[model samples]
Target: MSFLCLHFTRNIHIHAFYLKFSRILSTQNAYLNRFVVSLRPLNN
Candidate 1:
């Protein structure tokens, strides 16, 4: 029925959003890690 179709569509949208967020989060984490490493002194 129409309700079932709507539910399916909503679920797909939420899943896609989560996937995109995860990708962005991973990229952000990598950038932060590099920044942290750069902050450390070479002698340490």
Candidate 2:
């Protein structure tokens, strides 16, 4: 029973970590996209 509880808590922690990491990744992607768009005129 204790092992089951530990496993459950670990799953929750991993889920939360993934959510946070994904959010950061999405924001970084947006920033990179904007940066690339800004450079378009210079490249032309």
Candidate 3:
């Protein structure tokens, strides 16, 4: 029973970590996209 509880908690932690990591990735992607858009006029 204790092992099951530990496993459940670990899964929750991993899920939360991935959620946070994905949020960071999406924010970075958005920033990169904006940067690219801003640079397009300069390239032309």
Per-candidate TM equals: 0.85, 0.95, 0.95
Residue range 1-44, candidate 1, lDDT tens digits? 99999999999999999999999999999999998899888738
Model 1: lDDT to the true structure: 0.96
lDDT of each: 0.96, 1.00, 1.00
Clash counts for the predictions, in order = 0, 0, 0
Which stretches of model 3 miss by more than 4 angstroms? none
RMSD of 2: 0.5
Pick by TM-score: 1 or 3, better one: 3
lDDT of 3: 1.00
Model 1 CA deviation exceeding 4 Å by range: none
User: Candidate 3 residues 1-44, lDDT tens each?
Assistant: 99999999999999999999999999999999999999999999
Q: What is the lDDT of residue 10 in candidate 2?
A: 100
Error of 3 at 18 (Å): 0.2
Name the 10 consecutive residues with the lowest summed lDDT in model 2: 32-41
